[model samples]
Every structure is written in C-alpha cells, then in structure tokens.
Target: MALTQEEIRKIITPLLLSGAKMLDRHCPRCGSPMFELNGRVFCPVCEYREKQKKTETGDVEKILKEKLNELASSLPEEIDELEKHLRVMEKIIELLERYKKLEGVK
Candidate 1:
C-alpha cells in the first residue's frame, strides 16, 4: 500500500529521533557512557591511553613505520570515501530542509 507524507513522517520521525539519541549516548570504544572532555566525547579510560608512552624496540619501530607508510598511502582513498559520503549527506540535508519549508515547519 502507498503511504501518505504524514504517515511516512509519523513512522520515520520517532525512529530518527531515537537513533540520534542512541548515537549521542555511547562511547565509540568499550560501549560505555561517554563524557565530554575538551569538546570531544570520549570514554575516560580510552582518553587516558594518550598519556601512555610507546615502548617499541628498533625492529618493532621499523616494522611499524613500514605499516604506517602503507596505511598512509591508502589515506587518499579513505578521504575520497569521506568526501562522497559528505556530498550524499549534504544532498539529504538540502532535501530535508526543502521538505520542512514546504511543510511550513522550522
């Protein structure tokens, strides 16, 4: 069956609000509650890892550096994917804004 615009919004609005609440609620790591620190949401334990010193041997550092360079070489592809996603999101936002304007809602 075909759905009306009001029906579609009634079905989607709650789901979107719930999803946003869930995304805003959790830590990316450990799935614990995140606290805002210095304008970033982070798990307290995960943030503490930044203070730990690396203890790599010469051989380990050499291997790590090689792996890092390999990963760095792939960054352009990663950046392209992010740019594509951002473009898609921008289009979605524009469409939503137009819909809201038509609906006479802010």
Candidate 2:
C-alpha cells in the first residue's frame, strides 16, 4: 500500500524543520524521503507518479488559539463586573448591620 500526499507531508515537514539528518533521498512523486530496501527505491510515504495535491488541510490549533484570545480579551470585563457586584453587596451588608445596631437600643 502506498501513502497519500498528505501522509508524506505530515512525516517529512516536521523532520526537515527540526534539521534532522536525512538518510534517504526525497521521493519524486510527493517530495517525502524514500527508503531503499533490497536495492529498491521504494516510497513508503506516497504513491508513485502522483501529481500536486489539491486537498485543503484544517488549522484546528490556530482556530482554538484565536478563540482563546477572544475569551481572554473578555475576561477583564467579566472580572470588573463581578467586582462591582461585590462592592454593592458589601455596602448592602454594611447598611443592614447599621439598621440592626439602631434597633438594638430602640
């Protein structure tokens, strides 16, 4: 079985970027490294005679990062609103305490 172009990309791109020493030559079909076994240049990463790929890949990590950034941007506003509510509740508690103190002597 031959690997698809996407499979070749997933395996090779990271290795190249990390500057790993390549032992095999790149495949003519998908640009992935091909290993030679028994004097045969067989590609385990891509089908032979394959053309340029037209498939679209998803960037899930990028989308998640953007969503996190949006959530972080709104967090300060949420914290501010909570702080305002806490201050109001504190004032109400203080007023109730004062009313109770006045009633104690009446």
Candidate 3:
C-alpha cells in the first residue's frame, strides 16, 4: 500500500522530535529520503534498513588495533594471565581481519 504524504510525515515526526537526522540519500525502492537514528540508517517510507558505511568499519578496526597494541605492551608475567591476554588479542586480530574483508566489498 502506498502511504500518503501525511502518513509519511506522521511517521517521521517523532524521529525528528527525538533528534534523528534526515539524510541526503534516498531510498532505492521508494525514493523517499533516508534518515540516520542512533547509528542506524533507514528509509521510513519503505521501512528498509541500509548497511552502515565502510568508513564506520574502518574506524572500528583502527580502535581494535590500538587496543591490541596496548595489551601487547602490558603483557602479564603470570602464565594464566598471559594466556587470557593472548586470547583477547587473538579476538581483536580476528575482528580487524573481518573488518578489512568487509571494506574490500561494496
């Protein structure tokens, strides 16, 4: 069903009141303007959720790398504590690699 302009406005009003941003990009399905709210990008008219931009992933990857470096430099002397630290470092490396792969695609 096609929503009237009034219906669209009704849907968007609360978001705007709560500080959701109206984005410049339009929806592929309905061509209605998209919005960004609480880090989520979506089209209110079509109710379609958009994937977050790759730049956001890049930022996450950088933070994980920095944390991994910090953990490495502060390694614990105890074997059990060292093992726990190594496990966390491994997870961070895994996340960094995953983000790198995602950035390669569209």
Off by over 4 Å in 3: 1-52
Instruction: List per-candidate RMSD values in Å.
Output: 21.2, 21.7, 8.9
Q: Give the top-scoring candidate (lDDT).
A: 3
- Compute the lDDT for candidate 2: 0.52
Give the higher-lDDT candidate: 2 or 3: 3
Model 2 per-residue lDDT tens digits across residues 1-106: 3466666577556555655555557767656666654455555455323322212112333444465455445544577786765565566556556655654554
Residue-by-residue lDDT tens digits, candidate 3, 1-106? 4557675767778778989999999878777778999999988766522233455676798889899999999999999999999999999998888887876775
Q: Which 10 residues in a row give candidate 2 its minimum summed lDDT?
A: 49-58
Where in model 2 is the C-alpha error above 4 Å?
1-77
lDDT per residue as tens, model 1, 4-101: 45633654354445442223565556554445534554454344333332222334445545655554455445677867655655665565555546
Per-residue lDDT for 86 in model 3? 99
The lDDT of each candidate is 0.47, 0.52, 0.80
TM-score of 3: 0.53
Q: Report how far off residue 43 is in candidate 2 (Å).
A: 99
